[model samples]
Target: MKRTLSAAALVLLAVVALPTAANALEGDSYGPGSCNSITPASVARGAAVSYSCSDFWVANQTVSITIDSSAAGVSARTLSTVADAAGDIQVSIDTAADPAGTYTLTATQGTVTDSSDFTVLDPADAAAAAASASDPSAGGNALADTGFAGTALPWVAGGLLAVGAAALGTVVVRRRQQA
Candidate 1:
């Protein structure tokens, strides 16, 4: 029993430690930079949104940052710099002149690619602004259903539940044993 417990402990320890090792090797799951996050991201249409991206790196790697708006007229600063020893590449954006909509923020470092979605809110988009503040995914469904763009997730989930119930019942046996 002691041996079995020790083995179990080792197995659990390996399971826990393996992910850490893999994560370290994989760096960040979403890759380098604030690529995984867009902080304090919303601002008035003509108002400036100053933000930065944290960096990540490997030896001899190249890093680039691009921020742009697909909404008619918008601009972003270009940052092309060699990563620091720690792979730090910081950048800022001036959203003051951009239109009101979501913009793409992409960072490329060697083989790793990361992106974050940010919104430039027009002071006039009150309904959209409110919906977005309530739920970020709501903006995409402005013409569709409520409760964000994932209003269908529950239905899909229900279907999965029904399938799961059928499978469970199939695996269970109810038979009267000879008395």
Candidate 2:
């Protein structure tokens, strides 16, 4: 009877201890006061090349923004603020005048700073860049280093405690049976 009770307790404990792992879909890499880069700041012939901040950033905070492209000689001279909560920011630049080259997108507000270096490729480039953007590996979070980075003793101790409890229960059951 004691052995059966001990085995049942261990099974129950294991069942309660199990944690549901959060998959990539359920997790949001951008959590609070973080910035992201969106691609292809579009523009017409002479109109200001358009740049945008994501709604994720805009809707989350009222941020100070200055979108400038020295290479294109065009800038977003709006007020010192913009918001992108859905993870988008749109501003315009001189697409016709400036030669095709890489341009920098810098947004700094609060404690977050984000930058994206985009190339002036034909429309074909948009699809490729968009594909790369969609990849989970490309997003901002630390990819190579995740989970259990710093000191990892708590887990070990917990496992040892569970094992000790099982062993003690087994010993008690054996003693009772012998007596």
lDDT of each: 0.61, 0.54
Ten consecutive residues with minimal summed lDDT in candidate 1?
Answer: 170-179
Tell me model 1's lDDT, rounded to 2 decimals.
Answer: 0.61
Candidate 1 lDDT over 55-166, as tens digits, reads 5565345667778767775666566656667665555566656777888877776677667788877777745566675674764434544547787688667755765564
Locate the minimum summed-lDDT window of 10 residues in model 2.
Answer: 38-47
Q: What TM-score number comes out for model 1?
A: 0.48
**Residue 72 lDDT (model 1):** 70
Candidate 2 Cα misplacement greater than 4 A, ranges = 1-30, 33-36, 41-50, 58-81, 84-88, 121-179
The digit string of per-residue lDDT tens for model 2 on 65-143 reads 4434555555543334556546454544444554445556666666766666545544555555666656778663434
Clashes of each: 0, 29
RMSD to the true structure for each prediction, in A, is 9.3, 10.4
Question: What would the TM-scores of all predictions be?
Answer: 0.48, 0.36
TM-score leader: 1
